[model samples]
Target: MADVKLDIRPVGAALGAEIRGVDLNHLRDDEFAAIEQAFADHLVVFFPEQDLTPDGHREFAARFGELEVINGLKKLDDQHPEIVVLDDAVTPAADVWHTDVTYRESPPITAILHMVECPPVGGDTMWINLYQAYETLSPPMKEMLEGCTAVHVNRYGAGNHEHPVVRVHPVTGRKSLYVNRIFASHIRQLSRPESRVLLEFLYRWCEQSRFSVRYRWSPGGVGMWDNRCTLHSVVNDWSGSRIIQRITVLGDKPTGLGEPRWPKFEPNANGASDFYDKNYPF
Candidate 1:
């Protein structure tokens, strides 16, 4: 919570908002701080009725931090090397319920997705709050997760990358449950059966309807999310074409600055963690 606030219309007790009085094409520094604070507070900020160009999208993303280069997509212009092009024209295989790239040792902290094209009917994105998902766990469950971490990897299908089952946001200082369905292979150092049971249970808890938000797109929509502690997916049920311009803000290790009551999180030193045989498809 900060001194000044912005217009936030929560989608649920955990997520959702429609911020007003700001334009991506021209935003002041203090105004940008307020928007960032609101994003940190709400986990998901929505700005509708915007028709941003590829250049506009890049400019807006740079205001936050460095940009990320994604593996797929073809529409991205060579001028903006960091922008990720997402659309039906790129790859035939669709992206399932998963977070962006968690393969790197320290993954990108946030992603700004701006809707440039949308289906006339459906094409919504869903965001789940891992913080609230962790908080809602029974006291016994919370205690059980203490000091626990898992591996998520990049795979041919949906990769299994290793990340902490529970992680704390470095900048915002909030704890989040980090295991995602796409990359969560097996908990490191655990037996097969044990890892299976535990991961299955945690996935169910995080995907529950209560701690999430779903946004239906209308061309000019943009969503900025803290990927450190949040899980999100784009809806592909639209049966038609939907395009979005995306840029990710590179982040340090989730446990970089350290915390009072949590275990230290580190996978590799080169900002890319050591890869293993989790063998997931991206």
Candidate 2:
């Protein structure tokens, strides 16, 4: 298996690759290693024509790390707690840009999504390379964020956590712009007005078209991404139903080269109103 060759093709200049010639359900050690290496190099990797069951999906994701149970409103499979069912009726369209579970002290490091159903049109997912987002920042701007941290609160206002403004990937040892518009409330060291301004700028900067890639979903297509160094959003343009099953790999507490500054917990400031679907579509 170590000698297995994989056909990996880059989908975009900034991020994403299409991986061929490997069946995820029947992966060999070397094949899986190649897939893992491709994921590290290309922030997101797409596998086409992979037919996997719920247990198979969980098995594939567990190879990277321990799997985390699906949280929030999404319902989990009664048999497999790690598998989260994402259907149009059960979950609202995630049109906002975010890294998964950033409100938690330990957000997921990676996520593997298997497309079980596809709409007649639209329903593409987009991903941004946060590493590129950080690298492209002006030197002065980078210096400004040296020791800053931002508050991230879940949409349900259940928990509040703070993560470094710029996170260093534990595996790659490279810096990435970590703050996102979905969960980030405000910067701890800045005034309310200042924090809002800065957060808006950083969010817009990270979402620039040049640093991102769009992936069209297909039946039997699987997408895997490093959540620690990427931001992703689902395009909700499709009218018909779209279905995807996701398994997330639990990550360690985020660490940075600079000392971390925790944000002040404001129980009433969870920003539930800012959620993508104010009606709680999910």
Relative to the true structure, candidate 1 reaches a TM of 0.84
Per-residue alpha-carbon lDDT of model 2 for 1-282, expressed as tens digits?
246678989999999999999878888889988887788899999999888877778778989999887566464557888888788987788899999879999998888988888997999999999999999989988877857888888878768788898889887788998899889987876656677789999999999999999988789899999999999998878988798888889998887667754444333366533333333211
Q: Kindly list the per-residue Cα lDDT of model 1 for residues 1-282, writing each as its tens digit.
A: 444456667766878687876777776777788888888888888888866777878888888778777665554777987877677666443335566567667788788888878788876788898989888888887765655667677666444444666687776777778788877776664544566788898888899888888888787888788787778876667777777777888887656222223333333434643354234222
Total backbone clashes of model 2?
0
Point to the candidate with the largest TM-score. 2
lDDT of 1 at 154: 67
Q: Model 1 segments beyond 4 Å from truth?
A: 1-5, 92-95, 157-161, 256-282
What pairs collide in candidate 2? none
Error of 1 at 179 (Å): 0.1
The Cα local distance difference test for each model comes to 0.72, 0.84
RMSD, every candidate, angstroms: 6.3, 6.0
